[model samples]
Target: MDNYRPVSFWFDSLDDPVLDLREPPAQVDVAIIGAGFTGLWTAYYLKKKQPRLQIAVFEAETVGFGASGRNGGWCMGTATGIEHMLSVPSLQAEGIRLQQALENTVDEIERVCQAESIDCHFARGGTLNVAGTPEVAKRSQQWVEHLHRLGFKDSEYCWLDQAQSEKRIGLSRNLGAYYTTHCAAIHPGRLVRGLAEVNRALGVQIIEKAPVFNYTRVPDGSLLLSTGRGAVRAEKIIRATEGYTESIQGQQRSMLPLYSMVVATEPLSPEIWQEIGLTRRETFGDGRRVVIYGQRTVDDRLVFGGRAGYYFGSKRRALIPATDKAVKIVEASARELIPALRDPALGETVFSHGWGGLMGVPRHWRPCVTFDERSRIGWAGGYTGEGVGASNLAGRIMCDLVAGEKSDLTTLAWVDDVPRRWEPEPIRWLGVKSIEFFGDRADRREANNQSAGIWGSLFNRFVG
Candidate 1:
């Protein structure tokens, strides 16, 4: 219950030698910044393609310390909605291409673990996207129809009627649901640590706590990445920083660092688990304007997360505890859906962990990847709360770009610039809070209406 101590869950389980690079070398074939999924996967693919290439990764903190380690642990194959992508053609094409590329990321991740013989409790039981209201149910119906039209027959998403949804998810308030077979739940921290171990075994160099201060383009057409302790020069550089891209040269202040928070309950009794009827080990999220997501842990505990509130402040900020009102709302929602958990004798399950981290979001809510051919600098981010599988695909694309390959991965378009710039620091924080407040209100109003109609449109425009 102590903030979901993943270190205890993961560290004792690893069997590989830890590589702690104290200082950067003089030169390398590739230098990657950030050690999350994107950075680690980039190194993984690069090593597979060119085993002799000198690859080095620089991390500001320990590997997986960012969102990669702290995320909700859902590995979904699809990106955002196809309709949302179709509304923007450039992003639409990119979305299609990325979806195709990511079709195997979940499998690939599982394969990597199996090949390495790492046990992270990876399960491909699927995910349930439940509707919290009739309006949301309508949207889910439209989405199912849309996916069928897009030739996604193999997606394995079934339309669960209201009764079926409530019976399956133990949530009576849900109107309907869409079940997708393409998602998997992973121990995020273990996955990251395992990847780091595999990378080191493959001869990839990883340096932790090495914050990159600056980089210079040498006259020889190479990059010299300067860190606080040392420097490393490489022929090509890849920026894999997700929410923390603001620290890199030419990338600073280019991304909006939005915060997301999660809370995990204490392990439940076997009786409670049986009563909940969630034995399939699937993840769940309601289709509300302010969506809430929950998943059953391998250890019989339930983890839930949602928008903490409107945040208008620093990108690297943490979330405060839930207000009494918010806690009551969440607890009541849980009880309403799970009768087994309603008994007072079960005792109150205190939240063991409550933490928040930043994620990058562009104006259009599409993942962006940029390549500078002349400078040999490439970057990718802006997953918009759906980065798990998307980041893996981005990692592969980034490696392809660095290797100068003209593969299908490079066909995706990249946003030339970041979204809107906010006011400096303190003012930006206030603005975030105001936006969050407004967004929450709009979500509630739209959810109460049978048809979002004008109010829904307004909410979409504001968030967009």
Candidate 2:
């Protein structure tokens, strides 16, 4: 248990450390892999829909051990590539429904937390996309306009001038802000842990430390999931292993695991917080090309993230830096955004914890949720580091799909939209590394007031 604390700061800060382990039964009505949010949420909703269904979630590690408990705590009602996905003319109506559904998903999570009596420090103060640069400010203005033109009401997305932006959160540079009321900052550790408790209360068998090696289909049409202990047969199986999809025998190229590192500052004093805003716990980030995000914890800690990379062939055991470049980069960025962090009077280092987690990015960089009626083998994943709220939405969608119920969610564009397999080994590694490298170069070039050059242009086209 003590060793698990080093995995991430959220795990280390968990107040309820007690864990319940169960053995996978001989068979179940539904067998879900991965005990993270997607798997657990799917189980919870499934049992809610059909109380008599015997469902079991098989986890390789303890509950919330994956990205669910180690994320940036921004439960934003958005997904990767959402803007582009919704902008297409044919998808306009469906996009509106999808966007509205995602926004409601945030409220759905809040409702669950309240109804279940989970105190996860959830505050829907919204998100502030700080335009700390003049360049970003113009783009921010254009973005809000684009949203309005796309049929989104002003209440969904609004622009703030430099003064209004600073009033919400004291970000440096002080140009403007792209604000939205569709985001909430919650303690992910508490949310995932609380969900587990609720699942247990609702009769969802959570088998911990049961790593599934691979799966097979029986002659009778049932799915057999093989573990070190034994094979557990089920009528249906759902794959929820987001970034860890590579661990599955034939899924090495299905989802690429992108690594994102994070760091958190010690709880600040009132004086320090006064200098650096975020009184409502609004999640904040800039329009940087490389991407970055930060949230003000309920207890006054600055939990910031966005140092990212991609490994070759999605290796599990990575050779990490001794003095993590992520920590230094985050600390430097945070200090620049909030000068109070650089106060010499606060001692040598204000950063108390540092950690990293993997996000599953599909080849097309869009989230995928599919259920094949014929095979009885369905999977929900490809969140690309933005799965927090999407997972909840996915749980509901997957439930409807598994139960054979039709709704607005089942026919969305992402459903059954399986991304093509990534190119083989060296090509995959080279392409991913190229994107990583060019992304970095683009950010650096912009910071130095230089053009991104041809490489950056090609990188943008490839990523888009």
Candidate 3:
């Protein structure tokens, strides 16, 4: 696999045909940069609300070429953790309202997918945060108490004991798990490609391979976007680029791109499936300081991923197919979580695919959706690793913000909440690397039944 580069299994399975616009119109009502979930969903809803408005989505590559196509396909409604939501004292009530709205978004996504006839193998099977270690179990219990105080009912989020957890997903080591009914599993590439088709059918122009170098305010109060090929001016511009935000000029500190690597095993045999089952297709993860996520693919493959490489300072970049070493770590971690998958009797632990992608992490660890009236610019991102469902909500919120319509989605907590810019240069690099190092150490300590020390407490209190 020397020549291997990071390409997601979802994208590999898709044969989504190229349907680039011949050229961007001389001018348009709205010009959106970055054709991932945010751009596609924004265009979809914007066109739905006002059919007469001309909309064009300009992509640096193709639609879903970024994190949209490469994610673990967890259509979870949570863009931030419960603790983060309650952080802002002034918006506590609004934050609760926002949580409810996110649950609604999950339903809305399914409704729209069905309406559009997009067969993305979407299953509302929910998610499980399993706790295999004592430290993780303690944390999981605390999280449940926190959720209960925040008024999440048993139907929405509930605790499952060891027996229940094992019965649900067949992972016996889990002392307990937090189960939520507000998430779904999806074939990300299929969903994004289907949305692109839906947008085109609705008269939205998708311009592929149009990398926007920069944008400037035009004399007439319009925005002029300079692409590698040419320039296009529009009345309003939406910066929907998430992980790729650094590529735009003068915005390097606006968002930090973190690499998440994934590996998927070949479809397990029927006997293996019986022994290690995720029968309901629930998304799974362990309660570790570092993020990890997995799901049972529709075709019976076990696709798992975790946070892997972190670049330093000016070196922040997207690593699509990450180094083989990083990918091996991800695969090994997955097997370690479920011993049956690594059993010698099962033969070689073969992974048919491995890939990586970048996700945007806000300096303050909060997702934001805002549109500036004075600048006629709209944007939404900073989902961390939770963009799958949040992008749909972002699109809906962006539609409301762009139209100057005061609606439920517009008044949400994350709207207009700008995070502080990251510190400059070496400081940023040092800070990020330190966090990653501490996170790995914490995970190791927990696995050994040791305490997480001061680093874990500091991270839990300060970082999301």
Global lDDT of model 1: 0.71
Instruction: Compute each candidate's TM-score over C-alphas.
Output: 0.87, 0.95, 0.95
Judging by TM-score, tell me the better candidate of 1 and 2. 2
Residue range 1-464, candidate 1, lDDT tens digits: 12324422232224432447566788998888889888999999999889999999998767876778767778887664434664465666655555666667788878888998766678887888888777778778887876666666635867888888777776756787888887887777788888888898999989887888778987877788988668788888888887787776665456667766666667888766665656777888877656666778788777666664324443354333444345446555655655666667756555555555567765456677776788788777778677878787778777787777888677765433334544566765665565566556656765676465665675566555
**Candidate 3 segments whose C-alpha is farther than 4 A from its true place:** 1-6, 19-21, 87-91, 314-319
Residue-by-residue lDDT tens digits, candidate 3, 62-113: 7788899899999997777545665556756776787788888889989999
Better of 1 and 3 by lDDT: 3
Better of 1 and 3 by TM-score: 3
Q: Write the per-residue lDDT of candidate 2 for residues 335-426, one digit (tens) a residue.
A: 88787777776544478888888888899888878888888889998888888999999998999999999998898777888999888889
Worst 10 residues of 2 by lDDT: 316-325
Q: Model 2 Cα RMSD, Å?
A: 1.9
